[model samples]
Target: MRLENQIAIVTGSGGAGGIGEAIARRFVSEGAKVVVCDIDEEKAQAVAGALGPNATPWACDVSRSDQVEAMVAGVVPMFGRLDILVNNVGFTVPGFLRDLGDEAWHHVLNGCLSSTFYGIRAALKPMREQKSGSIINISSAAGIGGAPGLGAYGAAKAGVVSLTQTAAVENFKSGVRVNCVLPNAATKSLTAWFDATESGRKTRAAIEAYSRCGSPEEIAAAVLFLASDDSAYVNGTVLPVDGGLSSRVACIDATIE
Candidate 1:
């Protein structure tokens, strides 16, 4: 019960295949009263129901400022206090930068990047006043480096990492810690996306082989660490739970010929 009686909101926690859902369940297990918010109403309710009394569901689009505000305002009355905010709503498209359409570029940016800004802005009022809170943004390993088809996605995620660090420093005095996590989990969405593309299929297999492809549980563990007091002194870090992939390198010339 590390988070006993704590109040937490996990955005975009509808799908069984998303990081948001995984974080919600993990928070519940840690004794937090979890508020599951998503654009998918039914799916959100279903997950909330499964988590029992401590979980509540709300339909919200993190991209919308009004919806984000309503979600936080509603949660405070329902749960009495807000201690943690996990920004996990994100989407991606696989295509080269030159081939990507304007709509696709904006969609990727809105979902992966703008949403994080909205969530943090909405949560800051309460957290600042209370003088204690933890905000964890779900970034990706692709954000840490350049990728073939993730032009927009990589850009957005990288912004999330930068946002996390800046917010942490700005809010340090208020006791609000902002941290980002670069998780390399093999969720269903990723698998299906890879299955549809040749290069994706090959890259996915290679990634799985080298990293063993982490489970949602593993990512959730790192998240809980940041959420709990164990990481009180830790802030503004882009912690990669990616099986050493973040620090790895491939040598092109194996021999010193």
Candidate 2:
């Protein structure tokens, strides 16, 4: 058990099919007590129940700083100590930059970027006191570059990447390894986006061409590696688990004079 005797909190893990749920299962299987949190109370409880007593469900809107702080405080009382914090909550609003409305832009940013900030801020105090911990922020390939029609989401994820780097540097001497994971996983969110409209389908098809859709388990494995001693030397890195797609750059060069 890589995470034996560790206590982890994973955000946005209440749904039936999502990255959060996968992370919960993976952490539990590796002997970690996980707190599965989501905005939907019922869904959170259901997922926790299915995972057994070791997994507790909590409802929280991470975008709110007070709620986020309280969530961490509550977890410490129940779990004794927090060893890992996984900022897995995220959302996306698909549309061209000009076509995107203000509400949608804020919605995506709050859910994806702001929530990550709140979670990390709340966890930092405890981790710093303990002087040892790991924080994993889930980013996206769109964050590494620019993705048309996903401006809001892409921007938010990019913020997460930058946050990870900054936090890692600040917390380096404290033994708190802050890292980010850019996963290419097949989940409800991605599936719905891919099936939304004709244009969405085409975009998704192009994405699938370079690599087969990765499973949630695959992503869980990466998170586990970051959270464990395997990555003790790794810090402030944005790992792209995109199956080589992000590195696939085409070249057109001339060798003739």
For residue 93, give model 2's deviation from the true position in Å.
1.5
Model 2: per-residue lDDT, tens digit, 35-139?
A: 999999999999999999889999999888899999999998777789999999987888999999999999999999999999889899989989889999999
TM-score of 2: 0.94
Per-residue alpha-carbon lDDT of candidate 1 for residues 136-254, written as tens digits (9 for 90 to 100): 99999989999788899999999999999999988878989999999875487776767888976887787765675777778888999999999999999999998877776744425
Quantify all predictions' global Cα lDDT against the true fold.
0.88, 0.89
* Clashing residue pairs, backbone N/CA/C < 3 A, model 2: none
In model 2, which regions exceed 4 Å deviation? 192-196, 250-257
